[model samples]
Target: MRADAKKNYDRLLAVAREVFNEQGVEASLRDVARRADVGLGTLYRHFPTREALLEVLLRASFDELTAKAKELETADAVDEALVSWLRETIAVAHSHRGVIGSMTAAIEDPDSALHASCLSMRASGERLLNRAQAKGLARNDIDGADLFALVGALAWLNDQPAHTSRIDHLFGVIASSILTNGVPVSV
Candidate 1:
């Protein structure tokens, strides 16, 4: 891609991200084009469909999260590392609340790229969980699937308009339970 084309693509991605976060996957491509100061053809050239755009956005978020998890592995305290990663994950989910819903819908399509994205995220999260568990900080039985489910539930619950405080409280409860070496608590 040419420099100008790359610039246009970046602009479109930024605009699309904002629009999607505000209005969800159903947000208008035309509005995105307008926001990016580009034509519909240009937007389509960069993202063939709404699903394509969503896949790119979600993959980017997952990649960032995985990188953060890797960095957190070196923290002085294993429990602290795990708690910090969970908090970061919650923040990411809160930032991309609508994108999570769209990604889930896309993943449901048997051959969707979102399925591949999900697999990658699961593997990345598993590595982080395994590392923390190996340190004898996180609960032995707490697997990546458990963390994924916890994050998903928290993300869904946090998406509600009036649940910010509740989400934080829920996250705290989950962090304490999962980070505990003993049996997980019911929160």
Candidate 2:
């Protein structure tokens, strides 16, 4: 890409993140372009579609979460590792309002722009969950898909104004339910 085009792309992404943070992921693309001081055509040239733009923005975050899961693999306690990753995933989902909906949809839509990244992130969490289950720490009845759905549910709960104050307590409750031996080590 030309220097100017690259600059515009970077600016658009930065502004989109800000706008999405303030207005949720469903915020208008026109608003993003206006906030970035770029023409709508310019934004389209770079992103093509809303999902495309979101794919670029979310891919980095998903990669980071996946890497975090890998690092947590060697944590002293399998249960702690799973709970920590779940907390991180929920936090990321909550950071971008309405993103959990896209993640949930993407997981079911193989053709969605975010499908691959979401799948990979889910797989990473699944590995952690499996490890915990192997050690008889996490519940065996729940699978990775169930764990992923729980993350979306937790994230959605956090997005609710009335439930905001209850997130931490709710997280603890959910984590404890998933664990088998005892309460999950505080994550």
Candidate 3:
């Protein structure tokens, strides 16, 4: 990439992050271009589509989440490691506000730009979940896909004003349900 084009790409990503943070993942691409002081044609030349742009914006965070899963895989407490990864996944999803829907849809669509990252992240969480289940610490009925869906659901709940105060309590309830002990946490 040329210097000027690379500069525009970087600025677009920075502005898109801010716009998406304020207006959710579905925020207008035109707004991102406008905020970045780039023309719509330039944004299109760089991103091609919203999903493509999101793929760039979220790729690093997804990679980090996968790395965290790897680190947690060897934790002394399998249950704690699984819960910790779940919390981290939810945080990542919630950070982009309305991205859960896109992620969930993308996971099922191989052609989607976000599919690879979503799949890697899901597989990472699945590994942790599988480890916990192997130790009889997590539910046997759930799989990696289920864990991914749960993350999406939890993130969506966080977007609701009515659920804001109860989000932590709800997370605890959901986490307890996944854990075999039946008594996970209150927050």
Candidate 4:
């Protein structure tokens, strides 16, 4: 890419993050291009579709989360590592509405541009989870996919004022269920 094109791409991704956080996945592409001070055609040239744009915008965060999962693999306590990783992931998912939904959907959609990124992150998480389960620290019933769904659900609940308070309580319940010989947390 040319210098000007690279600058525009970076600016567009930055502006799109702000817009998506403020608005959502359905945020206007024209508004994004306008905010980025680039032509609509430029934006289209960069990101052909809304989902494609989102996938690019979110790829870095996905990579970061996956890296975190890898680091947690060597933590002193497997259970604590899993809990910490889950909390971190859920926090990211709670950054704004529609993020978790997009990730969840993209991970399952084989045709999505984001699918490979999603799979990479999921596989990293699954490695940690499987290791924990092998040590009898985590329950064998759940997998990385299940954890992604749980994170998405928690994030959706976090979006609403009324359900916001339930996040910790729900997380506790989920943690207990995932841990072997764990006690159910009081809601």
Candidate 5:
């Protein structure tokens, strides 16, 4: 792709991601084009369908999370790395609420891009979880699947406008429970 074309494509994807997060999957492509200052044809050229655009945006987010996990793995403190990654994952889930909802609905469809991304995310998460467990910071019994499930539940619960503060409290409780050892308190 030409430099200008690539720039336009990237801008469109960025704008579309924000709009989709704010409005939903039903957000208009025309609006995305307008926001990106690109012609409608340019948007269609890069993303032929709404699903195609959504797939690109969702894949980008998953890729970012995967990269962050890899970086966290190399961090000095294993516990802090794992906690930071989990918190980042929660934030990503919260931001892409509608995308996640759509992905859940499409999980059973073999041809779904959402299904592919979901599998990729699981594999990426497994790598991080395994590393944390090996370091003896995270609980060995709680596998990647458990963490994934927890993230999904937390994401959905946190997406509700009225439950934001409650979700923060819930996350704190979860973190404390997962981090606590059986040792006696010093107090």
Candidate 6:
């Protein structure tokens, strides 16, 4: 964790993020090391496996989202806070092309390197949803698992060239469904 080694680690992480965005979780560690101008051993020294790198790539955003939700939970505009956080979640998932595919599975797998991060993200969203629901703003029946499914659907749309353009609309639709208009929603 010295200056030079830390520098290499950061460089490898940056390169890995870029590479993962372009080529996905299966992107080559060798290529990541090459792009970072570090040796393969250095990359391995920092990240043991592809899953380890993927976990690091997502952990920052998840932590940020969780922090944001904590702040937003106290906001006067509860629905807006939840919707904004939901959209931000979509954007985070969309940032890496194939991350959504892996994230859903990772969230379910207790042993995955990124499971705790995903759980933190989910808990954050649940807090927001509860805040909105408490004020009769959001549907009480829905939960974070519903949002996870929407993330997967939106991420799928994001991956396709044609449907990407409608992502904003999709986000709105989901938000509207979650945020109530005083009518009782069964599910």
Best by TM-score: 3
Cα lDDT tens digits, model 1, 1-187, are 8999999999998998889788766789999999999999999998888878877877877788778778876777767666666667767766775656655554457677677776666666777778778877677887877787787778877888788668777877787777756544333
Candidate scoring better on TM-score of 3 and 6: 3
For model 2, what is the error of residue 103's alpha carbon versus the real structure, in angstroms, after optimal superposition? 0.5
| TM, every model | 0.80, 0.97, 0.98, 0.91, 0.73, 0.88
Better of 2 and 6 by lDDT: 2
lDDT of 2 by residue, 19-86 (tens): 99999999999999999999999999999988899999999889999999999999888888898899
Please give the range of 10 consecutive residues that has the lowest summed lDDT in model 5: 178-187
10 residues in a row with least lDDT, candidate 2? 178-187
| lDDT of candidate model 3 versus the reference | 0.94
lDDT (Cα, tens digit) per residue for candidate 4, span 1-187: 9999999999999999999889877789999999999999999999998888988877878899899988998987887777887787778777755777778888989998889988988787788788889899888888888877877788788877898888889889887888885756343
- Per-residue lDDT of 35-122 in model 5, one digit per residue for the tens? 9998999999999888778888878788888888888778876666666777788888788765556665555566776777776676
The sequence of per-residue lDDT tens digits that candidate 3 reaches over residues 1-187 is 9999999999999999999999999999989999999999999999998999999999999999999999999898999999999998899999998999999999999999999999999999999999999999999999999999999999999999899888899999999999997666656
RMSD of 1: 3.3
lDDT for each of the candidates?
Answer: 0.75, 0.94, 0.94, 0.83, 0.75, 0.84
Given candidate 4, what's the lDDT at residue 181? Answer: 54
Scored by Cα lDDT, where does model 4 land?
A: 0.83
Between prediction 1 and prediction 2, the one with superior TM-score is: 2
Candidate 1's C-alpha lDDT? 0.75
Report the C-alpha lDDT of model 6 over 103-123, residue by residue, as the tens digit: 888889998888899889988
Q: Candidate 5 has what TM-score?
A: 0.73
For all predictions, the C-alpha RMSD in Å is 3.3, 1.1, 0.8, 2.0, 4.1, 3.4
Error of 5 at 131 (Å): 2.8
